[model samples]
Target chain A: SQQGEEDPQALSIQEGENATMNCSYKTSINNLQWYRQNSGRGLVHLILIRSNEREKHSGRLRVTLDTSKKSSSLLITASRAADTASYFCATEGPTDSWGKLQFGAGTQVVVTP
Target chain B: DVKVTQSSRYLVKRTGEKVFLECVQDMDHENMFWYRQDPGLGLRLIYFSYDVKMKEKGDIPEGYSVSREKKERFSLILESASTNQTSMYLCASSLWAGRPNEQFFGPGTRLTVL
Candidate 1:
């Protein structure tokens, strides 16, 4: 079963605009991670926010985790055409071992130049 | 940088044929994983190994099997390929899996079963 579910099946935006995506999970998690995948390519890890952390920033990417609501949000600032890709949210539940993650369906983001 | 490479970027096989997908990690990670991606289904874990000669089943492991002979190499096998098995297969590796860690993934193999 999928532990995480990302909102907005798809998004389209112009360059320089910010892109925000939301993800909600069912169970308690140790950490939540975000990944990016280009067309026909494997996924790349973007950032991970622990359950204790409420917000994290990496370059133009910002992640916010609301454990109370079992949800997380990823925000990309000043998006570029290169940022066009599918974004996925994965959760590492406390009951899961060996860092196993359950991924969501993902959100497709299109940044038009 | 951690590098994960799959044996093939694409493969085509007939139904009932045995298929092997190989993955190698240069980072000497202790954990390796196999997943299949399909349209609207996202990536689903098929199997994962934390050490050599050890394996664990994921949510969807009925149609797939995995072998990890060495710490850096993992192989995913399809006993009898079916048309419905055609999808994108991905391999990944990570270190110190006691907690959540970033996974490094191969380019992925697009397999087609006829």
Candidate 2:
């Protein structure tokens, strides 16, 4: 079974709009990371937020973490057509176990020009 | 830039045939992972290695086995391919464990079992 699950399986929005995706997890985590994947390609790491940190920002991307709720949200501000991709959230277990990331199903975002 | 390379971009095999998917990372990372992606099931881990000759089973490792005889390369093996095993396979590598250990991924290999 997957430990992380994302809401809003698919989303469509216009350019310059803000797109938000939410992820919920089942267990305690040391940190959560977001990744973007283009069609038929591998994923690219975006941002990572630790359990001790409530929020983080990277360029126009904002990520908020609420460990108490076992959830996190990714906000892409000033979205662009290039941002149209599948976004996934992955959780790193507390023990820093090697390569043990429980990933969410992912949110597919389609940005219209 | 970190480069994780998979040997094939696409593969097709018959049921009961043996299949091997190869992945190599140039970053000299210590950890490597293999995952399968399906339409609605997302990515599920099959196996991972922390170092040469060291392997661990992930969430879905029933039909898969792995070999890491070298530090930079990892191989995923399907003893006997099954129809249910058809999916996109991804290979990734990271420096170590923790939040800061961002994984670099290869383009992936889409495998089909006939």
RMSD (Å) per prediction: 0.6, 1.0
TM-score of each: 0.99, 0.98
Kindly list the per-residue Cα lDDT of model 2 for residues A1-107, writing each as its tens digit. 68789988999999999999999999888889999999999999999898899999999999999988999999999999999999999988876478578888999
For each prediction in turn, the share of the native Cα contacts (below 8 Å between chains A and B) that it retains comes to 0.66, 0.74
Cα lDDT of model 1 by residue, A40-94, tens digit = 9999999999999999999999999999999999999999999999999999988
Candidate 1 lDDT (Cα, 0 to 1): 0.95
| Model 1: DockQ vs. true structure | 0.81
Q: Which model scores highest in TM-score? A: 1
Per-model DockQ: 0.81, 0.75
Q: Residue B60 deviation, candidate 2, in Å?
A: 0.8
Which residue ranges in model 1 land beyond 4 Å of their true spot? none
- The TM-score measured for candidate 1 stands at 0.99
Which residue pairs come into collision in candidate 2? none
Query: Which tens-of-lDDT digit does each residue in B1-114 have in candidate 1?
Result: 999999999999999999999999998899999999998988899999999999999989998899998889999999999999999999999896876798889999999999
